[model samples]
Target: MLKMTKPREDETRTSAKKAGVITLTGQLAKALVQLAGLIAFSHLLTPRDVGLIGMVAVFLLLGELIRDFGLSQAAIQTAELSHGQASNLFWTNALVGLVMSASLFVAAPAVADLYNEPALSSIAPWIAVTFTINALQMQFQVRLARDFRFLTLTLTDVFSQLAGLVLGLIAALLGAAYWALVVQLLVASATLLVLRAGTARWVPGAPRREAGMSALYMFGLHSGLAQLVQYVASNADSFTIGIRWGAAPLGIYNRAFQIFSAPANQLLAPLTNVALPILSRQRHEGRDFYPLLLKAQIAISAALTFVFAVVGSLSEPLVRLALGSAWRESAPLLSILSIGGAAQALSFMAYWAFLASGNARQLFLHSLVTKPILAVAIVLGSVWGLTGVAWGFSLGLVVSWFISLGWLAKCDGMPARVFLSAGLYVLQSGLVTGAVLWLLNSKFGDHAPSVVILSIGFLAGGAIYATLLCLRKSNRTVFRSVLSPVAARVKPLLQRN
Candidate 1:
């Protein structure tokens, strides 16, 4: 038997902090690249062109999620994985990827028919090719994550994003229209696969049946179902809008969502990658992880709330700034969607809890109940057009957040009082920030330059949030802990200067 040395508390903390910083830096770089691409693409492509891609994106995203089949999560969460088991999983994932790719190719015409867009028939199949590549790389990526090789993971992600953005821009310049977006997807997936294979030291051995394989498969089955339901609930609005309102409105709506969700996707998502593996290890060792989890939840909630507040306040200016005046209609949608963004940012922690605790069944059950409610909300909201759908989507998110809290309390033994109190504190902070930003926006009116208004609102809201954080002892400790490393690095630089 191989003996593994358990890292001391300080060592573990230091390693985690380093990994967090690397992941955050990478995500920030990727977000900047994507933001730059969005600005250029918005100008290069018409709303119809963007919308056409959005219409096909639902199918493509579903195919990718289905291809994953939760096996990646299974690999990450499992404490002890043998070479044989890993090899078996690799084969299973590749097979599923091949099937999904072929399935999407065959179903492309039907998807096009549903959207009443013949162009989608060609677009969907090309996008579908990414699945096999993604599948082949799944275990490699998971192993990097499992071993906390975040630097390698971050490098791969950043380079892939940059490469894809460049390719997509070139394709757009060449008048590929919607195909530009397809090129971006294909290039990004291919780049990631190539990089992961090159970087990961481990290669899968020949597949062989191993003991305890059934448990992994079972866990993956539930996890995959939960993922499928969650995706459907989240994307149903886009699906419905594309079918009813066509590509233009869907394009605008999709852009608004992407913009508003930048912080969650870029920042919080990466942190979750760091959090899950650590938490899983802690759980297996019977260590109490609630303190770390709680602090993280509070920090993420506070930060994202502040971000969304600024976004809500400057929605019009931001849309104009980011996408140009041609996409001014996305402004209101962005504002409405910001509400959901805040809700999601906070509630997303519950997912980490569910996965790290090895409670895939509980996660699936929660999704089974909540996803239908969300789907219904989207369907009903569709009757009133894009704005109504945005409203409904936000409402659904808020509801899901509360429901998830209840589940965490009951199923995971999280203290309801403690969790709810922390949530309310963050909610209060967000409201105060949002209100201050709103007042500033109202006072300035639309006459002010966007840059000036945005600068004022951001500074003012940030000051208010910082002041509020200092007023609470717990918040102060959390803030200080987060900032201490940065302060330490800056102090030496300042002294040298």
Candidate 2:
């Protein structure tokens, strides 16, 4: 038994590293694909088309969240999961997904009526089918996640997105109107089918309803609820804008928000993917996780803040060049919202802490508190129109960031001072970024050679922020701890500072 376990332990270590690398690589690839796809699709489709899909996406997101109900997360986090547990969860997910999809299909007209968009009456149901298609692969996908076989996982996302991009473009070329949305959904479904077959090792079986699984279920349920609240809060602005300002203004807001959120979302996604399983294992072993968690938070938070500050300041020029003048309304919204974007990225570490510690109940409570605050902000801001809504939405997130910091300390045992130290680095970075942008804006003018100014400001801000971080004893120590694995590669860069 000891001899057998030795090799197994070695294999686990090797697999963990591979999964980490795969997670990062996959994020980079997917971001590139998504960026390219967005650019191409934007040229082909109007903002109305994007807004129509965005409206439908609200239901789709809600359905997907409901279908999940936290089972896959439970499966991945639980160390003692059995084959029977996997099978039971799979069927449960499938049943839930089917029901959700059918309900959405039937309710599409009502949703359209509520949103006051006649076009959405048909478009909504077509998007509903994705739930069923998603159901088909949920179990298999969960199993792949359980072992962190992320190479296969990355391949699946890359190929599936590629398929959707191709299909959507073709439909656009053929002048399929909103039916192009259907083609995108169908292509995505096909990709899921292919991915499910490729990655899943387990097959469906008669589920054995086990007694010990309740703990996992309870944890997952709370996690899911927290996730749901977070989702609704994040998208509240989009919903309000779509309903009140209509598709055109909503389109601008959505596009701007999407672009602003993309970097932080992409950076944290792969880390969170790897963090859950790894941290779950560590928790099970009764090891100290706070130090490791803090290190990751500091590194990610600093980089995200620095990058987003630059992006937010240069958003006008960036939007004009990339998205055309039709999207000029999005510039102010983008800048304000990027503040929230940066904070959201920083606070996300707490989410992982909550999950890792099996404290989703506390997390749910936090979201419960945060969501109402956000809702109020959005409601009040919408009075002034879409930009007002954006301001309110982003403001709420900034407030929530501080609240989350307190909760992270109280619930997850992360030290408060660590965040304080990182917060200083972030502030310095933001200030430097603002100064650089101001200088560039003054020298070159808003539209005159904006891209060049944008590029230089970004580089200068990044360099100064990094230099400040290295010079700071507290921040530097944390940074070194987080980047130690690649210290050799980064050593020259560090020295260059």
What TM-score does each of the candidates earn?
0.96, 0.91
Candidate 1: stretches off by over 4 Å: 1-14
Model 1 clash pairs are none
Task: Superpose all Cα atoms of candidate 1 onto the true structure and report the RMSD in Å to 1 decimal.
Answer: 2.0
TM-score of 2: 0.91
- Clash counts for all predictions: 0, 0
Model 1 lDDT, residue 59, Cα: 78
Please, what's the RMSD in Å of model 2?
Answer: 3.6
lDDT per residue for candidate 1 within 1-497, as digits (tens), equals 11112323342223777877888888989999999988999999999999999988897788888888788888878888777888889999999999999998999999999999999998888988998999999898877777677888888998998999999999999998888888888899999999999888788989886997999899899999999999999899999999888999888998898888788999887777688888888888898778888888888888888888889877887787779998999988988888888888767888888888898999999999888888889889888889989988888988988898899888989775676788778877877888778787777747898888888888988999878867878888988898999999999999999
For model 1, give the 10-residue run with minimal summed lDDT.
Answer: 1-10
lDDT of 2 by residue, 334-407 (tens): 88888778778777887778888878899899999988898889889999887789889888977887888798
